[model samples]
Target: MKKRFLGYPNWWGEMPMAVYTFIEKHDWEGRTIVPFCTHEGSGLSGTERRIQSACTGAKVLKGLAVRGSAAQHEQESVRKSVSSWLEKLHL
Candidate 1:
């Protein structure tokens, strides 16, 4: 058997339609989903719930939201934040 991982996404405009469509098209049962995104200000406003609603059988972990400006201009800090978040989850 093999394992797969989906990299973090960029959340925008309250609900990211592509992410929603991806979720809707796939079978997420028996999987772990950790949602992290960068946004201008929406800041993961409704994506977590959207993901939950779409993939009911998957385990959705707490999501991390970083400002889009920070993600673009503050690479080191974003890296640190992601590293710290992963550590906390023991990933």
Candidate 2:
């Protein structure tokens, strides 16, 4: 598997406004927002909270915490979890 690391600019720290703007701009109300994260050790690491606070109108679901190193081997588990979430949300 090929791994790609996405590096954002320093302004990424100011991303909450961008996130809010995107949600409003896209008119994504009544949609479930699943915020998943890959971390070296921290797991979900408050990303879900951030999304919840930023996207006030959307339903922020519990996030999946995947270790970065294990992502390559966790495809099946990830697929199953995502499928289950989709079924539960009926989306």
Candidate 3:
């Protein structure tokens, strides 16, 4: 993985718009974007698709969505899950 990151401001039920705005404000051509998030219950919620559509020139990978509660109370499990996800992606 290269030393690059794209961080977007997100809110529940607002990820699609946020991603669109992010894409509009930035240039992600020829880059691989991995989206990850912590949500209460709406896991990913088609945000991956939105991201792909918004950033048409970038490759959007399958993302990991952690439940906010699980992340808060099951730190070790979250860590393991994230590690596994990254490993699967060969990152």
Top candidate (lDDT): 3
lDDT tens string, model 2, 15-51? 3455456645653356567665555666665666666
**Model 1 stretches astray by more than 4 angstroms:** 1-13
TM-score, predicted candidate 3 vs. hidden true structure? 0.82
Model 3, residue 27: C-alpha shift (Å): 0.9
Instruction: Evaluate residue 54 in candidate 3 and report its C-alpha lDDT on the 0 to 100 scale.
Output: 79
Better of 2 and 3 by lDDT: 3
CA shift at 66, candidate 3, in angstroms? 0.2
Ranking by TM-score: 3, 1, 2
lDDT score, candidate 3, position 46:
78
TM-score of each: 0.81, 0.55, 0.82
Per-model CA lDDT versus the true structure:
0.73, 0.55, 0.75
Error of 3 at 7 (Å): 5.5
Strongest candidate by TM-score: 3
Q: Is candidate 1 or candidate 2 better by TM-score?
A: 1
lDDT (0-100) at residue 43 of candidate 2?
Answer: 62
